[model samples]
Target: MTLPPIRFTADEAWALAAALAAADACAPYAGAARTAYQKIAASMTGPVSVAARELAARIVALPSRTDAAVRAAVEEALTGNKALRLSSVDAEGRESDRVVEPAGLLTADGRWYLIAWCRTRRAGRGFRLDRITAAAPTGERAQPHDLAGLLLGSVAAGAARPVALAALAPPS
Candidate 1:
């Protein structure tokens, strides 16, 4: 037997699309919202059904939680000038130690990332919060570093240049 066709008005379709995008944005960070996204996907029947399903799948694949101890340590470090000793695993599966001056914590795509000045590496590094097994205060004060410059430099390198509105306008 064939299923009945589902229909939506143009406005309704636009509203659904916006809702789906919102759900996608929240799903990575919020467990309850991820469940809501699944429910929304279930209700979708026609044109937007595939898009909803894809968004739901993407949300399901994201990491759900950050370690409590690691999070607390990072938060504490953010409030002070002390350096932290972070025990983390590398991409190669080998564990390593890093003494970092905590600059900030950023959440992207449902995961927490630590942007810090790594004294060991002599540069800034972004470490995934989940991978940090342990965080301890070093008691020693952090040296002055250009945290904003490092973060902005990394973003500028890959970001697309902005276009001027006049360039897009046609002369009368």
Candidate 2:
């Protein structure tokens, strides 16, 4: 079924507004995107159906119970003066050095990523920090773009294609 555009009830509108305000006041991080979208969508007068409201509610509610330490780390990574040299193995199994100016840290689908401007790639790219063996301050830094400036929207996560997993019968 096709998802409808988000519409909000009075409570939803108020909640969303508060969420956006909190997000703005808190820090520039990836956790706030859903809330930000909800707040903005709530204010609009349109046909926000039950499905849309449910989706918005899920997004708004996702951030409430995260660990404090992880959250702090994200805030620091986004706003701190640090250039992390990320190492990755490409599809060709080649090691690469990606010098990036981290703008934010995004956690989605149980994965953490450093959203930064890749100096080598000469564009904005999301680097999975788990693959990074080293992250040290270069002592030289670049100005970070504002959250909205680097607004990737849905592009940050690529398209998902279905994959099958096979299970074998136990050996006798």
Candidate 3:
């Protein structure tokens, strides 16, 4: 079946607004977000649909949930369906490189994570933004991966909340 655009309830919309506000990583895209929101908002009057409201909030705070250039490159790769090379330091403080198919950016507890299909590891991985030292597009095409599925499987230690997971996902 074809996927329909996801909709948010009133509470979800409010949560998204709060999430966006706390998304300091995405602050650089404020102008773009406002422009996009304005364009979307222009179509409706007075009150908006829950989906539109949620979308406006998400758009305003989407992209660059970390270092602007690194996160921007990753987001560009995701939008273009291209592979990206990332240099990051793990918890061990050792640096490693990976070519990943970009999926989405997620923020939980004020920390940002880049969810992706890692060619180096041959699996899904979440790289913390602060640990990523460099990121650039590889020019190679990327295969599509289920963003939600990757997120579901990646969250561990029972630290992630369902509200965060739901608020961060892009429309299907």
Off by over 4 Å in 3: 1-20, 26-31, 34-65, 156-172
Candidate 1 vs 3: which has more TM-score:
3
Cα lDDT for residue 123, candidate 3: 83
Model 1: per-residue Cα lDDT over 55-142, one tens digit each? 4345333333456667667766766778999999867888989899987555555555777899998888888877888998888888
Model 3 reaches what TM-score against the true structure? 0.60
* lDDT (Cα, tens digit) per residue for candidate 2, span 1-172: 4455655676766565454544522233535665556556654764544444555445533343333343444345556656656566554667777677777666555555567777897777775544554455555666665433454564655422212111342221
TM-score of every model versus the real structure: 0.52, 0.42, 0.60
**Candidate 2 vs 3: which has more TM-score:** 3
Clashes of each: 0, 1, 0
TM-score for candidate 1: 0.52
Q: After superposition, how far is residue 146 of candidate 2 from its true place, in Å?
A: 3.3
| Candidate lDDT (C-alpha), each | 0.64, 0.54, 0.68
Best-fitting candidate, scored by lDDT: 3
Model 3, span 25-81: residue lDDT tens: 544343455554444344443344555565545553444535678767877787788
Q: Model 1 Cα displacement at 69 (Å)? A: 1.1
Q: After superposition, how far is residue 10 of candidate 1 from its true place, in Å?
A: 26
